[model samples]
Target: SCAVALEAVRDEAGLGRTVAQVRSERERLTAQLRGHGWRVLPSEANFILARSSRSVWLRDALAGLGIAVRDFPGNEHLADALRITCPANETDFARLTHAIDAALAPEAVLLDLDGVLADVSRSYRRAIVETAAAYGVEITAQDIARAKALGNANNDWILTQRLLAQRGIDRPLAEVTERFERIYQGTDDNPGLRMTETLIGDRAALERLRARTRLAIVTGRPRFDAQRFLEEQGIADCFEQVIALEDGPSKPDPAPVRCALERMGVSRAWMVGDTPDDMRSARAAGVVPVGIPAPNDTREEAERTLFASGAARVLRSLDELLEVLPS
Candidate 1:
């Protein structure tokens, strides 16, 4: 029996995002497509019908990977247009992004340390909560998240201090700084919070990426922290150099990104990162800024945030590098 069709424009509201959010996302996606050398048309609906000369080839390629995209060439104007339905949620958006990247392929990849190559939620975020609670301040994860949502939080110590001040409780810079360092870095007896860090990507995957093209680490972490993470995580062999916070001005300025590329002796590099500052910095430095769907953010949210911050692409995982870049 044939199933009866429902009314039009149904489910105008999505599970996690609204219709307007879908529109916004599609607009950003269209721009991203155009940025990557695809000829994209202005879309009015949640779905985008983009034009690429290799539309059919790419469509079949994605289909082979268990991903479906509509490529209809019977139409006159849209001879090689590919119609892709927008993802319903943030998570699916990231998956869609990965699929597209795998189909398109990238040249070089720059990496972000936290939230991309490593899960720092337990280590860094936990340290912030404990440090704030030590000063008799009752702060929740949601509160800290909101505080970080404010732009320019590359320095956690300064961020913590600002959050404390926002609560009308002003402490000496030294007091807040020392307490945060003690809990975050830990002493000989304390074991420190560094042990809480964990690798998010596979070692072999990174080795594969390194083999593909040049690799570097551009992070907001301090020099010692960056050094410890690279060496301890056994990923030091993966990158040519690390431009940490102490190396130059924090992100959104492009100084650190430029520093890394200059040190690596590369003329151009593609940047992979989780934060808006990372994207902004990459854009300013003339690097191709690619956003990562951070574990902490919804895929749609990360995509939108990064695009707004000038990212050209969004990726699901660093491991996907092996798939997104051609051998």
Candidate 2:
């Protein structure tokens, strides 16, 4: 019976205008979050699930500020999500606003597909190693890493070929390209590539950008594969446009990034990616190049790599974007 009292508060009906006041307060909090560029998911219930790359950090920050918020780190769909009960008072809302403003992103962001936005350690990179072994090339993931470290390289096919050559396995370029494409594209029955990827960026941040400014994808992947990944994550619609391999020459050529910006009709924007090619493309296109190197970047080598590629800013993860975006 004691628990019933707690449950009652969840749906407690009040005087005629009391419900109206609560709804008004909820809208106020939502608007406040939206104002600071947060994606406030629609909530018909008493609580809202706000997605952010810094969910854990935000939750901890709020708690230290004398407020409690529930963070769902267990749910893959909501790993970087926070389920917060609507603020009960203006004071609470004020505190929430302060915490959120501390982290945000640029107005418009063009994101890279594989390494920058998604975790490819077990997906794309793994596929590279597996495909190489399947072709009797026998290369380690480190080989792939070393190849990626070289800036101004975008085509994975080229990277694979270079790695093989370094290992004394020189073969016809066309042959290597064929095998790589076969493994990456996959056979119908085999489902060829694992692509066991996850969003390394904040869904909430992306949503906020979408609601306010332009958010798009400029990737070297074929259009079909990029769409497949986006559709699977239910975020295909998040981006305003997608410029894939089918759109033009891949990164480092500057075509894809230019295509994205042209499609979005924006002259100035931030190009965010995890490779030197991404940095080079942004620079070539005259946009602000923001680089996020491999997730396993050690000794800040990735940072150095991006900087060398003319990246205006280099970050470790998408989670850090909110904190590092230029004002």
Candidate 3:
């Protein structure tokens, strides 16, 4: 075994390359741990000595997530410290960082795009109104809000069709969807209503939150629209995952929320959203459901509906999340 190990080293050049890779990864790991609020000691070795007040909890949490780190339980000198080996490969290094981030933060945040992150009143809601109006049915913002509160109206096209049918004007799903898409995505000669959408909350605050925990989007929007909104807002990099309609069944089904969690390699997370469907989906996925009313939603009605649908907590605004989220 000693002779085989020596042969694997392949002499001074190979050994030097291995040493450089270890040191590079170590530096990156130290910086990541420090960013997660751990007190990482300077090291000249292939591992990091990091201290956290919840070192034992972190150790257990990482272990639950299938990552292991050496921990000192009773030693007076290092009871609150963990010794983590540096991962030489990028994939393992990312897994370690994500595990550490999840352990310290306790839960990553899953966000719904339309109403929670972006104000969709002039885009999606307006599309619904116009699509209904084209069929001679007048739908108000309050009507849209009411439809969303139903919890089964996760997809906007289906919601629009329902609204039209309720008004005694039945339209084919395909026809209603075509009108909705034309209005939302716009024609070649005219920009789509999607251009009217705007982001809610402070971009800086969102970036700050993303620094502490992994962020993901689990939205009913098509994947293209979701990516376009994130890119247009210049906050695309803030999210680690985007689970869109194309990915699976829309919210209230829980499949999309669970899909996001699976993609993130996490089992614990908070889902921030605006509608009852979002709340139900998050809760069904065993995620902590946090609610924020859409700009167009009636506060009392929205809050009542969200709470009734299994929301763990409801916030006045997305920015308020900074105050209540675990540090």
Candidate 4:
């Protein structure tokens, strides 16, 4: 068959044309990868080897997206490299690079659990208030808002501890957390404040948004809490992945957001959250940061903190993201 095919295009003109086209695409792909910060090596063959820390991960991610790239994970010298074969035409080449972009950049929607997905005013916020009162510190909603604006209060337990400290009531973190979780999760015989939670956006609307883009959770909640909330809300399947507290450092550190993106196997994404910490994390992870009003914050305060922390847009409702997402 190889001999027959060669004979069919045996003419020097046809052979030269094919060789020129392949060489052109190979050069184009190399240039494109280099422009995107990939350390692409000079190639005289059918594929280009590009060095990236994401080489192993990208190989797997692209495979999931139905594209193939070779990674030399077992080779000491090439373990950090991916060898991408050049596509034969401009259209396929365009597709190849687009997939690469999606893997290397934010391409999905990452969500914050407490404020954005579930209305936590009656749940987590109430837990904070009740827990502080137990420690003899009467912190108001405004105080919580102020604390959140600091961009390091993603952990409600820690926030409660800090609020107590501000009131001259320095409580042990373990003690404060014990009380906070008890109130939030409740005992087997008692209903917890978590029951007060409700979905911020309608199920149908979320489904619509999910249909339009990939969805995932990047929350400060422990994996158990996050999972329970999603399951109880009957929306567990809406997101592709969940990056919980156990995954890494909480919001404002960018670790959780990046973990979520990496788990989803795409780099580019938009993150919708309500706290300054959420905005900062998304921005640091190179994801578009969109903000919604925190349950305990006034619109003015929400706007001020969210924007200052790097929110590209502040939305009135989660559903508004459908309007904001690019078509």
TM-scores for every candidate against the unseen true structure: 0.68, 0.62, 0.68, 0.68
Candidate 1, which segments miss by more than 4 Å at Cα? 1-107
In terms of TM-score, how similar is model 3 to the real structure?
0.68
Model 3 steric clash pairs: 186-192
Worst 10 residues of 2 by lDDT: 98-107
The runs of at least 3 residues in candidate 4 whose Cα sits more than 4 Å from the true structure, single-residue gaps closed, are: 1-106
- The CA lDDT at 170 in model 1 is 92
State the lDDT of candidate 3 residue by residue for 1-327, as single tens digits.
Answer: 999778868787877887888899899988887887889999999998999776765675455345678987679999999999986777887777766665456468999998888998898889999898888889998888877888799899999998888889888999999999999999999999999999898689788888767899999989999999999999999999999999988888989999998998988777889888888887666566778888877788888888777665678876676765566
- Predicted structure 1: clash tally: 1
Candidate with maximal lDDT:
3
Cα lDDT tens digits, model 1, 280-303, are: 787666566777866866678667
Q: Number of backbone collisions per candidate, in order?
A: 1, 0, 1, 8
Model 3 RMSD in Å is 12.1
| RMSD in angstroms between candidate 2 and the native structure over all alpha carbons | 17.2
Whole-model alpha-carbon lDDT for candidate 3: 0.83
TM-score of decoy 2: 0.62
Comparing 1 with 3 on lDDT, the higher-scoring candidate is: 3
Assess the local accuracy of residue 167 in candidate 1 as a C-alpha lDDT between 0 and 100: 79
Q: List the residue pairs that clash in candidate 1.
A: 90-300
What C-alpha lDDT values do all the predictions have?
0.74, 0.70, 0.83, 0.80
